[model samples]
Target: MPAHRPRGAQRLHGTLPAARVAARATSPQAGGSGSATAGSGCVHSRRSIQVVAFRGERVAGRISSGDIEALRERADLASVIGDYTGLKRAGTRYKGLCPLHEERTPSFTVDPARGLWHCFGCGEGGDAYKFLEKVEALTFPEAVERLARLTGYELTYEDMSPGQRKALGRRTRLTDLVGEAARFFHQHLFTDDGSAARTYLKQRGLDREAAEHFQLGWAPDRWDGLVRHLTNAGFGQAELVDAGVATRGQRGLLDRFRGRLIFPIFDASGRDVLGFGGRVLPDRPPTTAPRDGEPPKYINSPESEIYVKSKVLYGLNWARAEAQRRDTVLVVEGYMDVIALHRADVRNAVATCGTALTAEHFRQLEKFARRVVLALDADDAGFAAADRARALAEEAGVREVAVLPLPPGEDPADLAASGAERVEEALADVRTAIEFQITHLLRTANTSTPEGQVEAYRRTFPLLARIGDRVLRYRYIRDIVAPVVKLSADRIEAELDAADQEPSSSTAVEVAAAPRPSEPRDPQLRLERQVLQLALQRPDLLPPSWSKVGEHDFTSPASRQLFVALAAAPSGGLDDVLEALPDEDTRRRVRALALADLPTSDSAHAAQVIDALRRAAIDREMAEVRARMDTQREQLSTDERRSLAARIEELRRRRDAIRDGHEGG
Candidate 1:
């Protein structure tokens, strides 16, 4: 028999269509209320499919308010996350498909041991219960009951729960510990002897304060020197390993940033300590026997729980606020350049990791300021990178991309050593991306004659296509090219117009060539990571889940869906819990607890959810009605039940008025 639904209930309950329901919702029985599980005594009697939970047993718990809370606690988030993602082994954590949305490169992460997750890709973070509630649309009690059922636990509630408070405290301590570790490593860079790190920087022109400000330090060329120091500081090697600062693979234990000048990498938010980048001092490569043991010219902080290079900037955390303050960001090629600018009081400066400039890097700089000045070394690699960066920034819709070209053989370090005036000049006379590319290519291809002029235009104008500014592009062609190519300003203008009008024979070739500057595989990952980042940053800007949207709905399909889910479910930062998705290789089908993005904690908010739920249900029903009317309207009276059909039509009328009357979107 169907559960008896009171006609005068506080909220209406009915299954409208498959679209509005969870993937696991069961079909309604004939002559039934279409509800599988009745709301428990403590729960509101508005549930549809009776959500059942199991712990590899025959119904260990039911989706009641009491059991739900327990499951919220004990839900093995790894299992729940495994369903959508195909995770791979990434040290201690299992990484896979970013459930927040579609990702080719997994920025979505999960720490099963801690039952915590965070998507560096999108800024979503939280514990297991919160993740499910947000991602899967489970109410707090519903999530709790589901988890309890999944884990066979009894969620007996209390008036004053300490879980949230305790968890907050733990996070503070962990963050502090990471900070202390960064400080310790930074301090070692100063005191370590025979290290010409200071001499080298002085030779190159960076002062002590600048070095220290950037946490520039030399790792004591010894294998376990850091390990011993960290141990004395009461931090376990395991923790070090987990943080991705050191490793203990087969060589027992070793420092990851040994004998190198360390540059710390922090997220754009400027809060979480992500990781580090290390550059070897000159003459200290493996060939030089400084203490007889040192590695290569460069080393990076291994990807740790807090660090994903794809989502971090070497100096943006320190730069973003200043950039936000000053309305500009100084982008340099190396860590020394970033430090030099900072030491010169130009706080809005950042550098790339060992990786080349990427779209992900641009995305971080995007939020801080409008103008982006690229400080490149006046060398081949630097010039090449400048060209690439210009093209990339233009493609990404950055308006003011400037090139800060240092004097030949002199870097920011040398410039800083020269004096503050030199740094000021470099900062002041920044070249726009178009002007820089045009001038750089003219110099590269030898613009001495008509052929040279044609070659220069061929090499440079393609980059101009990316420049969103037409007037500026024409001006660049007129002012810069007229002089370099000995062409008149009018001639240059006509050439630019003709160039814009016709399709270049090399369009496809250049498009293909531009993508593979260093790694062809990077953009897809960068794009996915950016989408995840936006979704995580503003989940509320989106709706609840992807199931509600069409497959091709979002501008960036994966990111939009994740954003919607995050927005739909703001579960105490459940976006973080999504990081715990299990690896596909592990055969982890799913954790029943993590069905939703984040669960609502307050049952009182259940009333609040009623509006969203009704909207979602209405959408589902409307879609079904449209589909049915399109396919089966001819036989509408033949197969359907009259009462149910009438209810559907009535619901549509009510929802349509609400949607059109400024009540619904």
Candidate 2:
């Protein structure tokens, strides 16, 4: 999650306030995911030594600023990192494909500084403290705490001793402090002062169970109340400021949110409180006047280390598993609506965080379910969002998009407040994408005028054409033309013909006549990939048995690099090499390739992949030879044909130079 910051304590979608002014790891201009500076090897932590410091990396008593760095240097970074990735070697270092997701090649890089190793793949660097925070998925403080326990040490204010490793910086402690502050807010919500927010929830139809399930909270009107409470809890203002919970003002540091209805935001795991969303108690329409240029309602936690607006969908962490189980995702427009739906037993409902859907969002949703039900407000903006979402999802290959229309002037919250049945009724009668678009077009058309009728056709055809699936296109076309264009069946048929006709006949001919050329490759590639995967699974396989002569002929740039990496990896296993892969996706791709090496159900699939690659190489070469022979026959006379035959025999002899005893194809 990219940390988002607000201009005047106001919030933006999918962003949390930024912290850690460390050297900007990568310039935004790099134009890709993963940021690593030149000359910086993959940073890492020594996992072999278990010490539970504050968050759980080193012993609290023994940890110093330098100690973390030392631990990283001393720890076998390659060994510890291999657990998450498949590794190989570059010239001087071990490399691996990243494990975060999938990739066909390695980007994870590692350095064997005494106690730590670093992963360039995910832009994570540091010692055991850092590794735990990055890979083991521990907060810095949690990693410190874990390490402290492991080393049987206690935390103190003593200055870090000289020569201690450079664990991650103190910023990690703030994540823990934010968790504490979230607990503080939840506690305050149950107090008498929280009566209004609690009442608001209850009146909106959220029962006690739903309230507690969402961990609803309240913030007092006073700016400094939260600050005071956190102070008494032993957290410093610096930590709170970093968490975006408090800030340093002209007079003094004070709470970031006050006098609002607080909703704690959780990570995708449904475990960590990454940020908060607060709906101003006296919520007003966006058009309302504000005393200090504030938005009329709905303020979110500022950009912090934990939130990125483009990524976070409010209520999704809790709804994903449910959505997966139901095989459908219900989307509403506001936070309270999600609460209402969940309370009403529709656990699969989620909402955007005060932002419209984007392509990034649709792709994320596709991971869990294909069915998307958009429950936008009945207003023009809501309808526009629905249209945009339908087009976006269709472009991304989603199978179904259903648009549910809310009652006029009623948002999801209002509909739910009126009655859950009305909400359910609307959702239950969800309109398929085409029908929904056509109905909207009809409603908007001015049928009284001839111009209006023509305008209707203009609006309708474009919508129909956007539906990519050919099967669905005609289904929608039938629905639209049935009432409007049906009077002239031949004309409608002619229109369909116009649409079906190629825009450029020459282009169409070129597409149709295109030959499917086989990829030029060698069987050695698959064998090398398999060998590297096995070596990654168990490094002991890397002694003297591996040979590079057979696999170097691979043509895919990425796979070839991986092969070369494994063949040269100095001391680490394939895990080290994979940990070196720069992104989670690349690592996962390598894993997908390596799944062939695993003793799992996909073993047959793996075999198929290897066989396919090797076979393609042979088939391609054979096809080339046949093509040459045909050309040879076309241009040669009788005497030339005999000479060509002699040349063919020589080519055959060269082809027969295979090491195996079997005859060449």
Candidate 3:
């Protein structure tokens, strides 16, 4: 959960007061479901009901149900979910492998009609906010704030009470501080004190336009320059520290960035600054000597409340649209490589921040493009990095991974320095990830004899085996594998057969729609689930007898809880009932049941199902009585035995009546 900040005392660097800012009502941008309009309101917390008195339109400052609904209306759920996983149309809904869980087949589904999703495989389900909460690990308020930004809606809390505002103010302030710090660093780069940093940029072949475009900055040699500037601007030292701009020192608070070139890090939205990546000057005596606490080459801000290194890509803010447009994203090594690529016209480049290519990073990029081109150096370290990248990409289920072959002794930054056209030309001839792996191995293998050829094949066959597509895998075997090993394509194909290795297609894998591994095996539990599933799927078909069904009649604990929530719903809508559920997991189950395809709504079939559950309930009660009698037979007095016998008989009668298809009630 993100830390909560209160308003008023919470000061962000650039955010203006709600009272001073005008509410500009605009339509939702492209890729959204639609515009947030007035009158549509929704309440998130349990026990909260739809109150029509307040409107979603800009009020004095308090957030309204209408405002939330309007935001919800504008966010397209399928499109948002698609950003996290590959979704293919499945009837009116969309289905994809759940990013929330590991599975061979896709069971995650998104209903564009309702702007909701549910995964039958993992039983995770929710609307946009809930999806964001689970996928991004965001709190409710944070999710709301993100949606508001995505929809380009201006939010105000003037109508909210002071206490409520205070609770929400800290986050606002931290974000503001980062934004202010970015501006300060950028402005400082042009000042007289930034002469050395400016010269460094020039030597790298970067110009003024490049610096401003990438929001490049320079931190002065002194410690308190940024500290004093931010504090004088009404931000406290504590706030600066919290935002990762400053660190606690022996004396007091000290700036985290000093005597370095700064690159502001932003989240994918490109709106708020999350942290900074700083590069030490080349000419300066290393501040990161063995005795010094600094790193020798580069240092990024420590992970804080807002900046999560694994989840962020350095140039994503500027490169996402271009990556999507080109259907490819270029993965680079450093901030300068990304900036240099962008400086040349290769805009679809992003870098990992002082970290290895993580599975999460690949998952994030997989959403943008079907293919990823790793633009790494052509050195031993680069080859190792490429191999690690290939493994992570495979783990994340990325469709294609290609390695950009750079000239020996050159990096992307070095190549980009020449011209954009040269970079583009190099990109034109790229090797598939498998080909790169094979080439890498052959270069190391002593393939001067039959034994050497066999060794090379032994190493390369595993790489080809990992390729998911059968056709593509064989193509690589024929085109690249057979010639290298001095064998016909049939011989290599026979080797694959002898090895019993088969390629796995990501799209072909299927997770059967049956009882989930976690589902209860008790017969009555299935009955309870079936009844709830029907009612959830076709709530309108709920007969008047639904009022007679009680939570105690269900055997499954989760099912009983959902039954009570559904029976208590005022609107009888799935969303309304979902909002009323007691906990998130239970709500997720309800959503899964609601979204599942089940028997059609029919009064007769519903009655039969209801009666079956009633019979099961009576049998359960009778079994309990019989068990009591068997255990306490010797201990019971005459009167007690008689009473137990009578109770058993009563339950038996009820069970028999329900078994006969008569209404026990």
Candidate closest to the true structure, highest TM-score: 3
**After TM-score superposition, what is the CA distance of residue 282 in candidate 3 from its true location, in Å?**
1.4
Q: In every candidate, how many clashes are there?
A: 43, 112, 16
Ranking by TM-score: 3, 2, 1
Better of 1 and 2 by TM-score: 2
lDDT of 2 by residue, 1-665 (tens): 11332222211111121111011010111122122223434343322222232211242222233443433334455666665577787766777776543566667666664444554556655555555445433434345433433333333322333333233234345555666777677778889988777887777766666767787777777768889987887877777887789878889987777777788876543435667877766553222223454543566777765555556677776676567766788887677878877766677888766455666667666766779888744444444555557657865677788878777766666766666687678777788765776777767777767677655654565455444465666666565654663334345434544643432331221111111122112223333454456546654434321332235345455766666556656656657667666678777777776555342223333333333334434433443444334322322345554665676566455434422324333
Instruction: List where candidate 3 sits over 4 angstroms from the true fold.
Output: 1-154, 157-167, 286-295, 378-380, 395-397, 501-665
lDDT per residue for candidate 3 within 1-665, as digits (tens), equals 11332353222123422211112111121232222222222225421111111111112233334456667777888877776799999789898999877799888988878777888998877788777656654435445555665555554333455754554466557767877888888888999978888999999988898787778898887867899999999999788887888888788888888888999887764556678988878867334233533344567888876677887889976776577667789987788989989888888899987665778899888867889998755544455566667767877899788989888867788889888788878898688766877777777787789998877766665466555466777787788877877878777766654443221221111110112344433334555776888787765666666766787788556777788788788877888899888889878877877777664466656665676667656755665555445323433456666898899788877777755645444
Worst 10 residues of 3 by lDDT: 505-514
lDDT of 1 by residue, 1-665 (tens): 11332332121111111111122111122332222222221222332223221100111112333333334445677877775466666898887666665467778888887667778777766666556554543434344433444454433322212553343234333444455656766677677463577888787666776665565666666777777776787776677777666677576777776666776665443334566777777766632223433444556776654455655667775665467657788866567667767777777778766555666667657656678887765544455566556546755666677788778766676776667887788777788765766677778876667898766665665555444455766677677766777767676556544643332232321221122222222222222332343234433444333234332333333334444544455362644435333344211222222332332333223222323334444644544444333223322333343554676788778665643444433
RMSD after Cα superposition, model 3: 23.5
Stretches off by above 4 angstroms in model 1 are 1-177, 187-212, 215-218, 229-237, 249-251, 267-272, 282-294, 378-384, 394-397, 466-470, 492-665
Location of the lowest summed lDDT over 10 successive residues in candidate 1: 52-61
Q: Report lDDT (CA) for all predictions.
A: 0.53, 0.55, 0.67
My TM-score estimates for the predictions, one after another, are 0.48, 0.50, 0.55
